[model samples]
Target: MGKKRVIQQTEEELIQETTEIEQKLQGDVKVAKSGLREGRIYIKSTYNNTIMTLTDDKGNTIAWVSAGKIGFKGTKKGTPFAASKVAEALSAAIEKVKVSKVMIYVQGVGTGRDTALRTLAAKNIDIIGIKDITPIRHGGCRPPKVRRV
Candidate 1:
Protein backbone atom coordinates (compact mmCIF):
# COMPACT_ATOMS: atom_id res chain seq x y z
CA MET A 1 0.00 0.00 0.00
CA GLY A 2 1.08 3.58 -0.67
CA LYS A 3 1.18 6.43 1.84
CA LYS A 4 -2.14 7.05 3.57
CA ARG A 5 -3.83 10.38 3.05
CA VAL A 6 -5.88 12.07 5.73
CA ILE A 7 -8.81 13.98 4.34
CA GLN A 8 -9.77 16.91 6.51
CA GLN A 9 -13.30 18.24 6.71
CA THR A 10 -13.89 21.96 6.85
CA GLU A 11 -15.80 23.59 9.67
CA GLU A 12 -18.86 23.91 7.49
CA GLU A 13 -18.81 20.20 6.69
CA LEU A 14 -18.27 19.24 10.33
CA ILE A 15 -21.14 21.47 11.42
CA GLN A 16 -23.36 19.97 8.75
CA GLU A 17 -22.53 16.49 9.91
CA THR A 18 -23.47 17.31 13.47
CA THR A 19 -26.67 18.99 12.34
CA GLU A 20 -27.69 15.89 10.47
CA ILE A 21 -27.16 13.71 13.50
CA GLU A 22 -29.15 16.13 15.64
CA GLN A 23 -32.00 16.09 13.18
CA LYS A 24 -32.18 12.33 13.24
CA LEU A 25 -32.19 12.22 17.02
CA GLN A 26 -34.83 14.91 17.31
CA GLY A 27 -37.02 13.01 14.91
CA ASP A 28 -36.55 9.73 16.70
CA VAL A 29 -37.57 10.94 20.15
CA LYS A 30 -39.14 14.16 21.27
CA VAL A 31 -38.19 14.40 24.90
CA ALA A 32 -40.86 15.75 27.20
CA LYS A 33 -40.13 19.12 28.76
CA SER A 34 -41.01 17.67 32.14
CA GLY A 35 -37.41 16.55 32.40
CA LEU A 36 -36.18 13.18 33.53
CA ARG A 37 -33.71 12.36 36.28
CA GLU A 38 -32.88 8.71 35.87
CA GLY A 39 -32.76 6.77 32.62
CA ARG A 40 -31.06 4.05 30.61
CA ILE A 41 -28.95 4.17 27.49
CA TYR A 42 -29.03 1.04 25.43
CA ILE A 43 -26.27 0.68 22.88
CA LYS A 44 -26.94 -2.06 20.40
CA SER A 45 -23.95 -2.53 18.15
CA THR A 46 -23.80 -4.90 15.23
CA TYR A 47 -21.20 -5.69 12.63
CA ASN A 48 -22.87 -3.35 10.21
CA ASN A 49 -23.95 -0.49 12.46
CA THR A 50 -24.19 0.85 15.99
CA ILE A 51 -27.54 2.02 17.36
CA MET A 52 -28.11 3.80 20.65
CA THR A 53 -31.43 4.37 22.34
CA LEU A 54 -32.10 6.55 25.36
CA THR A 55 -35.00 5.59 27.57
CA ASP A 56 -36.50 6.81 30.80
CA ASP A 57 -36.43 4.62 33.91
CA LYS A 58 -39.75 3.20 32.81
CA GLY A 59 -38.08 2.05 29.58
CA ASN A 60 -39.77 4.53 27.35
CA THR A 61 -37.54 5.57 24.47
CA ILE A 62 -36.59 9.20 24.63
CA ALA A 63 -34.18 9.28 21.71
CA TRP A 64 -32.10 7.08 19.50
CA VAL A 65 -29.22 7.53 17.07
CA SER A 66 -27.16 5.41 14.75
CA ALA A 67 -24.05 5.64 12.61
CA GLY A 68 -25.99 5.57 9.36
CA LYS A 69 -28.30 8.28 10.61
CA ILE A 70 -25.26 10.38 11.51
CA GLY A 71 -24.18 10.57 7.84
CA PHE A 72 -21.91 7.58 7.73
CA LYS A 73 -22.37 5.47 4.63
CA GLY A 74 -21.52 1.95 3.49
CA THR A 75 -18.77 0.32 5.53
CA LYS A 76 -18.11 3.57 7.33
CA LYS A 77 -21.26 3.03 9.33
CA GLY A 78 -19.45 0.36 11.31
CA THR A 79 -16.45 2.52 12.17
CA PRO A 80 -15.47 3.73 15.61
CA PHE A 81 -15.59 7.35 14.45
CA ALA A 82 -19.24 6.95 13.61
CA ALA A 83 -19.84 5.41 17.00
CA SER A 84 -18.33 8.44 18.78
CA LYS A 85 -20.54 10.70 16.72
CA VAL A 86 -23.57 8.69 17.73
CA ALA A 87 -22.59 9.05 21.38
CA GLU A 88 -22.13 12.79 21.00
CA ALA A 89 -25.57 13.18 19.48
CA LEU A 90 -27.16 11.02 22.17
CA SER A 91 -25.44 12.99 24.91
CA ALA A 92 -27.06 16.11 23.60
CA ALA A 93 -30.48 14.51 23.89
CA ILE A 94 -29.57 13.16 27.32
CA GLU A 95 -28.75 16.66 28.53
CA LYS A 96 -31.91 18.04 27.02
CA VAL A 97 -33.97 15.60 29.06
CA LYS A 98 -32.12 16.71 32.23
CA VAL A 99 -31.37 13.14 33.17
CA SER A 100 -28.92 13.07 36.06
CA LYS A 101 -28.19 9.40 36.40
CA VAL A 102 -27.75 7.08 33.41
CA MET A 103 -27.34 3.35 33.22
CA ILE A 104 -25.62 2.15 30.06
CA TYR A 105 -26.44 -1.27 28.70
CA VAL A 106 -24.04 -2.33 25.97
CA GLN A 107 -24.64 -5.20 23.59
CA GLY A 108 -23.02 -6.82 20.56
CA VAL A 109 -19.41 -7.39 19.52
CA GLY A 110 -18.92 -4.55 17.11
CA THR A 111 -16.05 -2.19 16.46
CA GLY A 112 -17.98 0.77 17.89
CA ARG A 113 -18.82 -0.72 21.29
CA ASP A 114 -15.86 0.56 23.30
CA THR A 115 -15.36 3.85 21.47
CA ALA A 116 -18.93 4.93 22.14
CA LEU A 117 -18.57 4.46 25.89
CA ARG A 118 -15.37 6.49 26.01
CA THR A 119 -16.86 9.40 24.09
CA LEU A 120 -19.98 9.43 26.25
CA ALA A 121 -17.81 9.55 29.36
CA ALA A 122 -15.84 12.46 27.95
CA LYS A 123 -19.08 14.35 27.42
CA ASN A 124 -19.53 14.45 31.23
CA ILE A 125 -22.83 12.65 31.68
CA ASP A 126 -23.44 11.22 35.14
CA ILE A 127 -22.98 7.64 34.04
CA ILE A 128 -23.90 5.53 37.05
CA GLY A 129 -23.34 2.02 35.72
CA ILE A 130 -22.01 0.20 32.69
CA LYS A 131 -22.99 -3.34 31.91
CA ASP A 132 -22.23 -5.72 29.05
CA ILE A 133 -25.42 -7.43 28.02
CA THR A 134 -23.97 -9.30 25.10
CA PRO A 135 -25.45 -12.75 24.86
CA ILE A 136 -23.30 -15.82 24.90
CA ARG A 137 -23.89 -19.49 24.20
CA HIS A 138 -24.09 -21.52 27.36
CA GLY A 139 -22.81 -24.76 25.93
CA GLY A 140 -20.77 -25.84 22.94
CA CYS A 141 -22.45 -27.42 19.95
CA ARG A 142 -23.50 -31.01 20.44
CA PRO A 143 -20.74 -33.54 19.93
CA PRO A 144 -20.49 -34.88 16.42
CA LYS A 145 -21.93 -38.32 15.81
CA VAL A 146 -19.48 -41.19 16.20
CA ARG A 147 -17.32 -41.71 13.14
CA ARG A 148 -18.40 -44.46 10.84
CA VAL A 149 -16.70 -47.80 11.46
Candidate 2:
Protein backbone atom coordinates (compact mmCIF):
# COMPACT_ATOMS: atom_id res chain seq x y z
CA MET A 1 0.00 0.00 0.00
CA GLY A 2 1.17 3.49 -0.77
CA LYS A 3 1.99 5.86 2.10
CA LYS A 4 -1.01 7.79 3.42
CA ARG A 5 -1.16 11.38 2.32
CA VAL A 6 -1.63 13.96 5.05
CA ILE A 7 -3.43 17.21 4.36
CA GLN A 8 -2.06 20.34 5.98
CA GLN A 9 -3.59 23.81 5.84
CA THR A 10 -1.29 26.72 5.07
CA GLU A 11 -1.25 29.87 7.24
CA GLU A 12 -3.12 31.75 4.52
CA GLU A 13 -5.77 29.03 4.46
CA LEU A 14 -6.27 29.31 8.20
CA ILE A 15 -6.58 33.07 8.06
CA GLN A 16 -9.01 32.89 5.14
CA GLU A 17 -11.21 30.38 6.98
CA THR A 18 -11.24 32.55 10.11
CA THR A 19 -12.11 35.65 8.09
CA GLU A 20 -14.95 33.85 6.34
CA ILE A 21 -16.42 32.69 9.63
CA GLU A 22 -16.25 36.18 11.09
CA GLN A 23 -17.92 37.62 8.01
CA LYS A 24 -20.72 35.06 8.18
CA LEU A 25 -21.41 35.81 11.80
CA GLN A 26 -21.42 39.52 11.11
CA GLY A 27 -23.74 39.15 8.13
CA ASP A 28 -26.16 36.48 9.36
CA VAL A 29 -28.17 38.72 11.65
CA LYS A 30 -30.25 41.45 10.03
CA VAL A 31 -29.59 45.02 11.08
CA ALA A 32 -32.56 47.38 11.00
CA LYS A 33 -32.21 51.13 11.29
CA SER A 34 -28.54 51.22 12.17
CA GLY A 35 -28.94 54.89 11.36
CA LEU A 36 -32.51 55.15 10.16
CA ARG A 37 -34.10 58.37 9.02
CA GLU A 38 -37.72 59.23 8.40
CA GLY A 39 -37.88 59.57 4.63
CA ARG A 40 -35.36 57.60 2.57
CA ILE A 41 -34.53 54.00 1.62
CA TYR A 42 -31.21 52.35 0.96
CA ILE A 43 -30.90 48.89 -0.52
CA LYS A 44 -27.61 47.08 -0.72
CA SER A 45 -27.25 43.61 -2.24
CA THR A 46 -24.36 41.52 -1.00
CA TYR A 47 -23.30 38.01 -1.98
CA ASN A 48 -24.94 36.48 1.10
CA ASN A 49 -27.99 38.75 1.56
CA THR A 50 -30.00 41.75 0.47
CA ILE A 51 -30.17 44.64 2.96
CA MET A 52 -32.86 47.34 2.78
CA THR A 53 -32.19 50.41 4.90
CA LEU A 54 -34.95 53.01 5.13
CA THR A 55 -33.86 56.44 6.18
CA ASP A 56 -34.48 60.16 5.81
CA ASP A 57 -32.63 63.05 4.13
CA LYS A 58 -30.25 63.30 7.08
CA GLY A 59 -28.95 59.74 6.42
CA ASN A 60 -30.51 58.03 9.38
CA THR A 61 -31.69 54.49 8.78
CA ILE A 62 -35.34 54.26 9.83
CA ALA A 63 -35.88 50.54 9.23
CA TRP A 64 -34.39 47.67 7.26
CA VAL A 65 -34.61 43.99 6.33
CA SER A 66 -32.27 41.13 5.56
CA ALA A 67 -32.88 38.05 3.41
CA GLY A 68 -31.51 35.59 5.93
CA LYS A 69 -33.66 36.99 8.71
CA ILE A 70 -36.78 36.43 6.61
CA GLY A 71 -36.05 32.73 5.87
CA PHE A 72 -34.59 33.46 2.47
CA LYS A 73 -31.81 31.18 1.20
CA GLY A 74 -30.47 28.99 -1.61
CA THR A 75 -31.58 29.70 -5.20
CA LYS A 76 -33.91 32.30 -3.72
CA LYS A 77 -30.67 34.30 -3.64
CA GLY A 78 -31.00 37.69 -5.33
CA THR A 79 -33.76 36.78 -7.77
CA PRO A 80 -36.73 39.00 -8.61
CA PHE A 81 -38.83 36.73 -6.41
CA ALA A 82 -36.56 37.53 -3.51
CA ALA A 83 -36.85 41.19 -4.38
CA SER A 84 -40.63 40.97 -4.17
CA LYS A 85 -40.41 39.22 -0.83
CA VAL A 86 -38.05 41.89 0.43
CA ALA A 87 -40.40 44.57 -0.83
CA GLU A 88 -43.34 42.96 0.92
CA ALA A 89 -41.36 42.71 4.11
CA LEU A 90 -40.29 46.34 3.85
CA SER A 91 -43.84 47.43 3.14
CA ALA A 92 -45.00 45.70 6.27
CA ALA A 93 -42.15 47.16 8.25
CA ILE A 94 -42.86 50.63 6.90
CA GLU A 95 -46.51 50.38 7.88
CA LYS A 96 -45.49 49.29 11.34
CA VAL A 97 -42.86 52.03 11.61
CA LYS A 98 -44.88 54.76 9.86
CA VAL A 99 -42.24 55.92 7.36
CA SER A 100 -43.13 58.10 4.38
CA LYS A 101 -41.41 59.87 1.43
CA VAL A 102 -38.38 57.68 0.75
CA MET A 103 -35.53 58.21 -1.66
CA ILE A 104 -33.95 54.96 -2.80
CA TYR A 105 -30.30 54.06 -3.16
CA VAL A 106 -29.72 50.75 -4.94
CA GLN A 107 -26.31 49.19 -4.87
CA GLY A 108 -25.71 46.04 -6.89
CA VAL A 109 -26.15 44.35 -10.24
CA GLY A 110 -28.27 41.46 -9.01
CA THR A 111 -31.59 40.44 -10.58
CA GLY A 112 -33.35 41.80 -7.50
CA ARG A 113 -32.14 45.34 -8.32
CA ASP A 114 -34.75 46.50 -10.80
CA THR A 115 -37.50 44.25 -9.46
CA ALA A 116 -37.17 45.57 -5.94
CA LEU A 117 -37.04 49.14 -7.18
CA ARG A 118 -40.18 48.56 -9.23
CA THR A 119 -41.91 47.04 -6.24
CA LEU A 120 -41.14 50.10 -4.15
CA ALA A 121 -42.40 52.32 -6.95
CA ALA A 122 -45.59 50.28 -7.28
CA LYS A 123 -46.15 50.73 -3.57
CA ASN A 124 -45.96 54.51 -4.07
CA ILE A 125 -42.83 54.92 -2.00
CA ASP A 126 -41.91 58.16 -3.76
CA ILE A 127 -38.37 57.43 -4.83
CA ILE A 128 -36.23 60.54 -5.19
CA GLY A 129 -33.00 59.00 -6.46
CA ILE A 130 -31.95 55.70 -7.97
CA LYS A 131 -28.23 55.27 -8.13
CA ASP A 132 -26.27 52.21 -9.30
CA ILE A 133 -23.22 51.85 -7.09
CA THR A 134 -21.87 48.75 -8.79
CA PRO A 135 -18.36 49.30 -10.07
CA ILE A 136 -17.70 49.10 -13.81
CA ARG A 137 -14.31 49.04 -15.48
CA HIS A 138 -13.85 49.36 -19.24
CA GLY A 139 -11.18 47.67 -21.38
CA GLY A 140 -10.22 44.01 -21.60
CA CYS A 141 -7.79 42.43 -19.17
CA ARG A 142 -4.59 41.32 -20.93
CA PRO A 143 -4.48 40.55 -24.66
CA PRO A 144 -7.56 38.83 -26.06
CA LYS A 145 -7.14 35.16 -26.93
CA VAL A 146 -6.61 34.49 -30.63
CA ARG A 147 -9.90 33.91 -32.46
CA ARG A 148 -10.44 30.88 -34.62
CA VAL A 149 -10.13 31.65 -38.33
Candidate 3:
Protein backbone atom coordinates (compact mmCIF):
# COMPACT_ATOMS: atom_id res chain seq x y z
CA MET A 1 0.00 0.00 0.00
CA GLY A 2 1.25 3.49 -0.76
CA LYS A 3 1.34 6.03 2.05
CA LYS A 4 -0.39 9.39 1.59
CA ARG A 5 1.61 12.55 2.27
CA VAL A 6 0.13 15.82 3.50
CA ILE A 7 1.58 19.17 2.55
CA GLN A 8 1.44 21.99 5.06
CA GLN A 9 2.35 25.67 4.49
CA THR A 10 2.90 28.24 7.19
CA GLU A 11 1.08 31.59 7.28
CA GLU A 12 4.21 33.49 6.22
CA GLU A 13 4.66 31.21 3.22
CA LEU A 14 1.06 31.72 2.22
CA ILE A 15 1.39 35.49 2.47
CA GLN A 16 4.55 35.53 0.41
CA GLU A 17 2.97 33.47 -2.34
CA THR A 18 -0.10 35.68 -2.33
CA THR A 19 2.04 38.81 -2.58
CA GLU A 20 3.94 37.42 -5.54
CA ILE A 21 0.76 36.57 -7.35
CA GLU A 22 -0.66 40.01 -6.65
CA GLN A 23 2.42 41.70 -8.06
CA LYS A 24 2.14 39.65 -11.26
CA LEU A 25 -1.45 40.74 -11.68
CA GLN A 26 -0.50 44.39 -11.25
CA GLY A 27 2.30 44.14 -13.76
CA ASP A 28 -0.10 43.53 -16.61
CA VAL A 29 -2.10 46.63 -15.77
CA LYS A 30 -1.03 50.23 -16.27
CA VAL A 31 -0.36 52.13 -13.07
CA ALA A 32 -0.41 55.90 -12.84
CA LYS A 33 1.24 58.42 -10.61
CA SER A 34 1.03 62.19 -10.19
CA GLY A 35 3.71 64.80 -9.58
CA LEU A 36 7.05 63.19 -10.36
CA ARG A 37 10.43 64.93 -10.20
CA GLU A 38 12.62 62.74 -12.40
CA GLY A 39 12.95 59.22 -13.82
CA ARG A 40 15.80 56.80 -14.55
CA ILE A 41 16.26 53.48 -16.34
CA TYR A 42 19.21 51.13 -15.89
CA ILE A 43 20.21 48.48 -18.42
CA LYS A 44 23.01 45.98 -18.08
CA SER A 45 24.13 42.78 -19.85
CA THR A 46 24.81 41.01 -16.57
CA TYR A 47 21.09 41.18 -15.81
CA ASN A 48 18.70 38.80 -17.54
CA ASN A 49 16.21 41.57 -18.36
CA THR A 50 16.16 45.35 -18.32
CA ILE A 51 15.42 47.19 -15.09
CA MET A 52 13.33 50.39 -15.13
CA THR A 53 13.44 52.58 -12.10
CA LEU A 54 11.59 55.91 -11.80
CA THR A 55 12.93 58.23 -9.21
CA ASP A 56 13.31 61.85 -8.20
CA ASP A 57 16.38 63.93 -7.41
CA LYS A 58 15.84 62.94 -3.81
CA GLY A 59 16.77 59.40 -4.86
CA ASN A 60 13.37 58.01 -4.01
CA THR A 61 12.23 55.22 -6.26
CA ILE A 62 8.69 56.01 -7.29
CA ALA A 63 8.26 52.90 -9.41
CA TRP A 64 10.45 49.98 -10.40
CA VAL A 65 10.21 47.07 -12.86
CA SER A 66 12.25 43.92 -13.12
CA ALA A 67 12.78 41.90 -16.30
CA GLY A 68 10.51 39.03 -15.31
CA LYS A 69 8.36 41.33 -13.25
CA ILE A 70 6.65 42.61 -16.40
CA GLY A 71 6.27 39.35 -18.33
CA PHE A 72 9.51 39.76 -20.26
CA LYS A 73 11.75 36.74 -20.70
CA GLY A 74 13.80 34.73 -23.16
CA THR A 75 15.85 36.47 -25.90
CA LYS A 76 14.24 39.77 -24.99
CA LYS A 77 17.51 40.54 -23.28
CA GLY A 78 19.41 43.50 -24.86
CA THR A 79 17.12 43.55 -27.88
CA PRO A 80 14.67 46.09 -29.20
CA PHE A 81 11.96 43.86 -27.84
CA ALA A 82 13.40 44.33 -24.39
CA ALA A 83 13.63 48.06 -24.96
CA SER A 84 10.01 48.29 -26.03
CA LYS A 85 9.01 46.14 -23.10
CA VAL A 86 10.79 48.49 -20.72
CA ALA A 87 9.04 51.46 -22.30
CA GLU A 88 5.69 49.80 -21.83
CA ALA A 89 6.60 49.08 -18.24
CA LEU A 90 7.66 52.67 -17.59
CA SER A 91 4.59 54.04 -19.31
CA ALA A 92 2.43 52.21 -16.86
CA ALA A 93 4.49 53.40 -13.93
CA ILE A 94 4.11 57.08 -14.79
CA GLU A 95 0.69 56.97 -16.33
CA LYS A 96 -0.57 59.25 -13.64
CA VAL A 97 2.66 60.96 -12.58
CA LYS A 98 2.71 64.46 -13.97
CA VAL A 99 6.10 64.94 -15.58
CA SER A 100 6.80 68.18 -17.38
CA LYS A 101 10.49 67.76 -18.14
CA VAL A 102 12.78 64.79 -17.74
CA MET A 103 16.50 64.10 -17.99
CA ILE A 104 17.54 60.55 -18.86
CA TYR A 105 20.81 59.02 -17.72
CA VAL A 106 21.58 55.91 -19.71
CA GLN A 107 24.26 53.51 -18.55
CA GLY A 108 26.00 50.77 -20.46
CA VAL A 109 26.26 50.05 -24.17
CA GLY A 110 23.38 47.69 -24.80
CA THR A 111 21.21 47.22 -27.89
CA GLY A 112 18.14 48.18 -25.93
CA ARG A 113 19.55 51.51 -24.79
CA ASP A 114 18.57 53.43 -27.91
CA THR A 115 15.33 51.58 -28.37
CA ALA A 116 14.24 52.41 -24.84
CA LEU A 117 14.88 56.07 -25.52
CA ARG A 118 12.89 56.01 -28.73
CA THR A 119 9.99 54.34 -26.98
CA LEU A 120 9.93 57.05 -24.37
CA ALA A 121 9.90 59.69 -27.07
CA ALA A 122 7.02 57.98 -28.83
CA LYS A 123 5.09 58.17 -25.61
CA ASN A 124 5.35 61.97 -25.90
CA ILE A 125 7.50 62.21 -22.80
CA ASP A 126 9.38 65.49 -22.95
CA ILE A 127 13.05 64.68 -22.66
CA ILE A 128 15.00 67.64 -21.43
CA GLY A 129 18.34 65.90 -21.90
CA ILE A 130 19.88 62.50 -22.52
CA LYS A 131 23.24 61.63 -21.05
CA ASP A 132 25.22 58.42 -21.38
CA ILE A 133 26.70 57.58 -18.04
CA THR A 134 28.77 54.71 -19.41
CA PRO A 135 32.25 55.09 -17.99
CA ILE A 136 35.05 56.19 -20.31
CA ARG A 137 38.73 55.47 -19.73
CA HIS A 138 41.35 57.75 -21.29
CA GLY A 139 43.80 54.91 -21.91
CA GLY A 140 43.77 51.12 -22.32
CA CYS A 141 43.59 48.88 -19.28
CA ARG A 142 46.80 48.33 -17.24
CA PRO A 143 49.40 47.99 -20.07
CA PRO A 144 48.62 44.52 -21.54
CA LYS A 145 50.05 41.88 -19.19
CA VAL A 146 53.81 42.30 -20.01
CA ARG A 147 54.02 40.05 -23.08
CA ARG A 148 56.32 37.09 -22.49
CA VAL A 149 59.37 36.91 -24.78
Cα-based TM-score, every candidate: 0.75, 0.60, 0.65
- Report every candidate's CA lDDT: 0.86, 0.66, 0.65
Q: For model 2, how does the per-residue alpha-carbon lDDT over 22-123 read when each residue is reduced to its tens digit?
A: 454344333354323346677877655677876656776656776665555676656676666677677666655656656677887667777778888888
State, as a TM-score between 0 and 1, how close model 1 is to the true structure: 0.75
Q: Kindly provide the TM-score of model 3 when superposed on the true structure, using C-alpha atoms.
A: 0.65
Query: Residue 28 in candidate 3 has what lDDT?
Result: 48
Q: 13-73 in candidate 3: lDDT tens per residue?
A: 8788657644763654433455765665444422355666776666566676655665544
Worst 10 residues of 2 by lDDT: 28-37
Q: Judging by lDDT, tell me the better candidate of 1 and 2.
A: 1
Candidate 1 per-residue lDDT over residues 38-125, each given as its tens digit: 8999999898999999988888888888888767879989989889889988888887788888999999999999999999999878
Q: Is candidate 2 or 3 superior in lDDT?
A: 2
Please state the error at residue 46 of candidate 3 in Å.
Answer: 6.2
For candidate 1, the per-residue lDDT at 60 reads 81
How displaced is residue 66 in candidate 2, in Å?
1.8
